[model samples]
Target chain A: MSFELFSNLVGAFFTLCIFSFLYKDNPFYQAAEQMLVGISLGYGLVYTYNRVFVPYVYQTIIIQHQFVLIIPAIMGMLYLLRFSRKLGWLSRYPIAFSMMGVGMGVPMGIHAAILVQMRQAMVPIESFNLFLIFIGTIAVLLYFFFSKAHKGVYGKFVNVGKWYMMIGFGASFGLTVMARISLLIGRIQFLVNDVIGILK
Target chain B: MKKTIPLLIVIVGGLIWVVWAFSPHYVLQEVFYNQFYLPWAYASASFAMLLGVLSLTMMHSNKIKMRAPKWQYSYFFFASFVITCLAGFIGGIQKGGLFMWMFENVQMPMSATMFSLLAFYMASAAYKAFRARSPEATVLLIAAIVVMLAQVPLGVKLSKHLPTISQWILDVPNLASKRGIMLGVGLGSVATSLKILLGIERSYLGGD
Candidate 1:
């Protein structure tokens, strides 16, 4: 068989292996999962080495004569020392570096998610939908606010908020299933058009 | 010295970004952060990925050595990893190479199939659990049905207005609830970050 056809056949096998899980878990599915994990990790390693390491580390410090780049390079290499027992403690420095980077994003998240979303919700009520949305936003916020007792008028808002949240979750579930169904259709198309040569 | 230095590093390293956010000084923004800190992060991330690969390989190797249950699958992992790495290094990752062929044939189909499998599981779960016994459940069930119908051509044929109503449900109440959740989460994270930066959150430091 030609290489292209052979590739298609192999693809069909893996697809079938995964589809087998729908019926029940079996060795074919397990093997396919393990192989995928290995292959993707391998591919990621090579891609990272070529894409990030080559230019950022190797080319920058070695060829471009940027000596200061060695600081982070050394810090990066500290991860390898994690395998050593005594030197393992040294890995915390790099961990702290990465964690600090995460910490940095807190303000960014506050600005983007909190401030921006709040501003977006505060638009003037030009339409009926806007009126509902404004009340929904306030009600949801009040529902989450646990400082005061959820009694009296606050309790009523909380109920409306709960309804809004339920509807929101249901919509999310529907969209997610639709997305997965589309992916299912894609795999089915490949099997028919590529493997069986029936739908081409 | 080890503990003190790293803790100090955490505080200083964290404060640097916070300073960058508020200050926008030329030195902090263009000089130090862009030129120095960014590359450090990239290099550190690459190493972390390598660390993950190494850890997984070691785990599988140990599993084979111990002859654990389903250990036979470990060999397949090794073979796949070795073969893919060889293909990538020897043939290069350019188009039409062994690496790309393996990825196209083996990886993409399997991954896509794995994700698509969720559709069946979700459908089954919905069938088993989506009983509308209460007023709240009735609202949820109705919303889901409306949205799902709007996703296909059948909905348009069924009612012409189904799609518009679905869109409004998503745009209004759905968005409002999501915004509330995001605001709550953002506030919590900001508090935690401040605690960490100010040295109040010593749980991360661990061991005295």
Candidate 2:
């Protein structure tokens, strides 16, 4: 068969496999799910090795013959010791180091991007909007404040916050719903355009 | 010796790495990235994938030996796994071939299906949630109805104003709520990372 015909056939079969899940769990769906996982893991491994390890370690250590790569290379080898129960404790050195490294790296990276941006977002852009911002901020703060009962002067502020919070939640829920609906629409479009080729 | 030595190394090494990452020196940053961070990520993920493959093989092999009712299904799974892996290995040799085909044909559809399943679930969930038993429920019901109706062409045909209202709802209120969520997520992530860095949350290491 021609390549286009072969691809179209494969696409049709996959669309069927996906739609089969709607009828309840079945062999086809299970196969599709497992295949998906296996392929993703396999692809991810290859990508990581090629894109990261090859250039970083293989070139620097193997080709350039750098002695500094030895330490991390040894650490990498130590990770395989996890297969043994007695020596597994040694493996935690690498795991802990890596986790800590990532833990430290993420915040250091994110602090400037997310935290700073959020603080900026919280600050109102307009003078007239400051009142709304102040009320919204105070009300939201009061809603979370559990140290004292909001029954007196703070009660009104708390009420305002409660209303704003409700509106926020409602809007979030609405967006989430729309997102799901769009997914459904896209699937339906695929079924028509690709699988059955009715739209063509 | 088992716990103390490893914990101490982690504590000292972690601090050093943290300092190394934030330092303004370009050389220190490059050393950390090339020598420590990248290699560590590759080693951990590779080992995890090996464990996953081993588990998959073991599960299927057990089913086949026991003559389970779904033994054929296990065989199919094992065959698919082997085929896909071999395809990827072979395709890697040639730069592009069977692996690309399987990814585009099999994997993408499955991902799309998994995401699409959320639609039916969300619809069912919304149906149950929007019962107008109280004033709050009534308001939610109305809001959901408006949003849902506004999304479709039918709603727009019925009222010229709905699309504008939908845009407003999405842009102003939706943006505000999402920003709030993003802030919460940011704070939570930072808190969790700090806990991990301080070695307070060591559950990720898979031991007491």
Ten contiguous residues minimizing lDDT sum, candidate 1 chain B:
B199-208
Worst 10 residues of 2 chain A by lDDT: A128-137
- For model 2, how does the per-residue alpha-carbon lDDT over A106-197 read when each residue is reduced to its tens digit? 55647754667457557755764444554554566556667889888788667666655555666667767778778767767776776567
Model 1 gets an lDDT of 0.86
Rate residue A34 of model 2 by lDDT: 62
Give the fraction of native contacts in model 1.
0.74
> Candidate 1, clashing residue pairs?
none
Model 2 CA deviation exceeding 4 Å by range: A57-59, A67-74, A77-84, A102-118, A121-134, A149-156, A159-166, A198-200, B17-22, B30-48, B55-72, B93-96, B134-151, B179-185
Q: DockQ for each candidate?
A: 0.75, 0.39
lDDT of each: 0.86, 0.65
RMSD of each: 1.8, 3.9
Which regions of candidate 1 are displaced past 4 Å? A198-200, B202-208
lDDT of 2 by residue, B68-136 (tens): 876767655666666766776666724348877777766776677678787787778777876767665
